[model samples]
Target: ATTSIAPTTAVATTSPVFVPVTEPPSATPPPTTDAAVAPAPATTIVAVDVPASTAPPIVVPASTAVPTTTLPPPPPAPVTQLGVVQDVAASGPLTVPVVDYGLPRVALGDSVMLGAAEELLARGFAVDAVKSRQMISFLPDMQIIRDGGSFGPVVVIHLGTNGPFSESTLNSMMALVVDVPIVVVLTGRGDREWIGRNNSKLRALPEFYPNVTVLDWEVVASQCPGRCFYEDGIHLTQSGQDFYASQISQLLGMG
Candidate 1:
C-alpha cells in the first residue's frame, strides 16, 4: 500500500507552439496605359490653295468679234403713149384705124392681149404689140401717128376685154377719135351662161355710135360647141384663139 502511494507523485513536461505567417504588401503594378490613347495612323490629305493677289480671267467666242455687210436695191420701170384713127369716107364704105404705143413687142394690157397678139403674129399681119398700162386711158390723136407710124383705113379695136369701162369714159374715148369706120370687137363673156346673156344686153352701144360695128364674141364662143376656153375659163384655147384671130383677119381683109 505504501509503494503505490509514491508512484502517484511524478511531474508533467510542456510541448512546442507553431507561429502565423504574415507577407509584406506586393509592389503595386504601374498604372495601366489605355490602348485608345495610342497615336493616329499616317495618311496624306490634299487641299487646293489659292493666292490672294490675283482675280479670275473671262473668255469670249470668235464669232461675236466680227461685223456684217449689206447690199443696195434696184431701179424703176419706164412710161409711154397710145391712140386711135379713122376713115369715114371711101368708095366701098367707112373704116377706122387703131395705133397703139408703149413698150415695143410686148402685148397691150394683159395675158389675153398677149395671146391675141401671138395669134395675129402667126397670121402674117405685122403686129406692133405694145406692153402698156396706158392702153386703157388712151385718147385718139395724130400724135400716135407722129410717134409710131400711119395706120391704114379699116381699124379694128379689140379692147375692154379686161373689164367694162364706164359709159361716160367710153363715150369720151369715142369722141376723141375722128372720121373712121370702127369695128369694136365685143368682149367675150366668161364661161357662165348668165354673163353671155348679160353681154348681149350691154352690147347695145352701136345704136348710139353710128360709125361703130359690133362683133359678137358670144357667137364666136358658140362655134366650139361646149369647150372654147382655157383652163382659166376667161382666156381662149388654141383652137378658139385661132378661130377668133381668123375672123378678125377676114373682117379687116387681111385673110
Candidate 2:
C-alpha cells in the first residue's frame, strides 16, 4: 500500500483562447462608375423672422429718362404813320421817289439885293433888283410878271429901303403873288425913321398868310455892327453880301 500512494499524480487538459477582430471605418466612400445616374438634389427652404413696420424694397429700371423745358413769348409789332420815317432793311436794291418843284426861285428887291445879285444868281435864283426904288412903285412889275406867268414857286421881296409904303400898298403887292408856294419878306436895315414902321407891317404878313416868312435883315445886319454896311448904313459890303445870299439860299432849301 505504501508503495502505490507515492507514485499517484493526475494530468490536466489545455483549452483554445478566442479574440474579437475589428477594422477602422473607411475615410471616404468607394469610387463609383455610374455617376450620371444619381438622383437630383431637392429644393431648400429657410425661414426668417421680419418686423411689421418694415417697408418693401423698390425695383429700378435700367434705362434713363429725359426732362422737359419752357419757352418765352415774342415781342409786339411796330407802329406805322404818315411822315414818320422808319428804317427798313432791304434784301435787294430799293428805289426812292424824287419830287419835282417845277419852278425856280424869283427874287425882287432894292439896292441891298442888287449887291448880292451875282452871288444869288449863281445859287439858282432869278433876281431882279432896282436902286433907289420904293415898294409902292413895284406893283406894276409884279403884275407884269404874274400876268406873263414868269413868277416861280418861291418869291422873295426886300423893300422899304428907299422909302416907306403904306400897309394897303403892301397888301396890294402881296395879292399878286399870294398864290405862290412860298413868299419870303425881308425887313430893311437903315437909320431912317420910316424903316421901323415899315418892318412892323412886314412882320404882320405871316398872321394873314400861312406861306409867308419874314427874314429880318435889320437884325442880321446889326450883328456885324459897322463892318456889314458902307458909310450910308444901307448898302452891303462884300462880306455882308455873302452873308445875305447864304441866308436866302438856306431859306429856299438850297443851302
Candidate 3:
C-alpha cells in the first residue's frame, strides 16, 4: 500500500569510488649492503731534498687527508772555519821575556824549519835543520839539537811538519833534553789528521816536563790564517817566517 503512494523515486545503484593514494618515497631502503663497505683514503706524492734538509723524515698515514703544502727543509749548517782562535787558548798567553838583545838559540825540524832557517840565522840562532826529517828520526836529530843546546839557552823543535809520531819516540826525544830549556811549537795540521795528532802530543809536553814551554804556532798561524801559510800549507811564507821569528823572539824576550 505505501508503494502505491510513493511518487516514482528511482533506486540508486551501489558502486565503489576509485581514489589515487601516494605513499612517501618508499622509506629509501637504507642503502642495504653498500652502507657496510669501507673506503680507503686518497694519497699524494712529494719531492725530497738532501743537503737542504737537516730535519728527520716525515711520516704520513694512508687514511689522512693530503696536505696542501709540505714544510720546507731547513738550510744546512755552515762549515766550521779551521784554525780558529780557540786552537791556541790551551797554551795560554805567551810570556814576553826581557830580551838579552842577541840571545843564542837553535832550531831543528823538517821543510818548515828549512823555510825558517834564514830567519833563525838572522835572529842570531845557531840553527841546524834538515829538510823532510820527521819525528821518527828523533834520536838522530835530538842528538844534534842536544849538542847545540849546550851552546844556546833555547831550542825550538819543528819536526812534525812531515808526519805523525809515536808516544814512545816522543818520550825518548823529551828525555834527551830535560835539563835544557826548550820551547816546543805545536805542529800545523793543514787538513791532515796525523799532523793534528802530532800537535796534540807536542801540546802535552809541558805537563810532563817543567823546563819545556809550549809555543802555540797553531795560534799564530790562525791570527793571519791563509796569509800566514804558503801554498803547501805546512811551509811558512816569507811573512810567516817573519811572524814565526818575531813570535819566537818575543817569547824568549829577544824582541
- Candidate 3 lDDT at 6 equals 50
How many collisions between residues are there in candidate 2?
0
Model 2 lDDT per residue over 1-255, tens place: 466556757665667578988988899987887668767888888887776766786788877767666666665332111111111111111121122543477889999999999998988888889998898888898798788776756778899998889979999998987877667788888899999999888877878876676777777566553476789888989888887887766655465
**212-242: candidate 1 lDDT, tens digit per residue:** 5555555545655445588766676777677
TM-score for candidate 3: 0.57
TM-score of candidate 2 versus the correct structure, residues matched by position: 0.60
| TM of each candidate vs. truth | 0.45, 0.60, 0.57
On the 0 to 100 scale, the lDDT of residue 176 in model 2 is: 88
Better of 2 and 3 by TM-score: 2
Please report, in order, the local distance difference test score of every candidate based on alpha carbons. 0.48, 0.73, 0.64
| Model 2 local distance difference test score | 0.73
Order the candidates by lDDT, highest first: 2, 3, 1
- Highest lDDT: which candidate? 2
Overlapping backbone residue pairs in candidate 3 total 2
Top candidate (TM-score): 2
The runs of at least 3 residues in candidate 2 whose Cα sits more than 4 Å from the true structure, single-residue gaps closed, are 1-103, 224-226
RMSD of each: 23.6, 21.9, 22.6
